[model samples]
Target: MSAQHPRPGITHDNRFFWEGLAQHKLLIQRCTSCHRLQHPPAPMCPGCHCFEMEAIEASGRGTVHSFVVAHHPPIPPFEYPNVIVLVELEEGTRLVSRLVGTPPDEVAIGMAVAVEFEQVADDFVLHRFRSAASR
Candidate 1:
């Protein structure tokens, strides 16, 4: 881990999500009652206010619903003009992650994407999006 690279602070509600990434599997929280799938794990479902959630392995497949090309304020561990995307999973949940394996200019709304993990620290992993057709 780079000394300047900040790490994610995990908590009970989101621990499973982080743990699942270590195994190279993308996990999202599913509401046991409403069946609503959500990301950034939470204790209660916003749709139905259900207090129970289950960790479900995502297909790691999604489509870019929105995105931005960030070029300012260069930061460590990230390239300038990064393609940040909002991926809408096939399961109907959405997550914001960096887009890779495709040029920043080529990134478009509705582009197909899939999950890929990058280990930023010994115990931390960042889930990023890549062009599904790249591999």
Candidate 2:
């Protein structure tokens, strides 16, 4: 089946990330200068201001730093009463996503999470965070 919702924000930096998701991989930008990894990929490293960078696949492991339960309605294509979260990856980068496989009230700081992708369109997929099934 194809994705249900598609919001393509294609750019030079993030194009790889989105493309990687379509293949079930999580890609992040790594700075060649300081060796720091960054999400929301950029051409320049915020750490050393270096233009040298490369794309690397991540382990897709992270922890929930913060989150909110969407009691109110969400934007189009998103159902209400969902959990959106700011996840801190083990690589030290934080990404925003929806939480799955857990109750809203059960979400807490430092809760272990893994990557989950939903194909919301034919050519696009969204990355969401979810607690491990063993939890």
For candidate 1, the per-residue lDDT at 97 reads 89
Candidate 1 C-alpha lDDT tens digits along 1-135: 633566677898999988999988899999999888988788899999999999899999999999999998878767877999999999889999899878888898998999999887777778998998887
Could you tally the backbone clashes for each prediction?
Answer: 0, 5
lDDT of each: 0.88, 0.84
Q: Candidate 2, 131: how far from true, in Å?
A: 0.7
Query: Compared to the true structure, candidate 1 yields what TM-score?
Result: 0.92
Looking at model 1, residue 78 earns an lDDT score of 79
List runs of model 1 lying over 4 Å from the truth.
1-3
Q: What's each prediction's TM-score? A: 0.92, 0.89
lDDT, candidate 2, 23-133, per-residue tens = 988888899888998888888999899999888888889999999898765566677679999999888888888998788888898999999888876777788888965
Clash-forming residue pairs, model 2 = 3-119, 3-120, 3-121, 4-120, 5-120
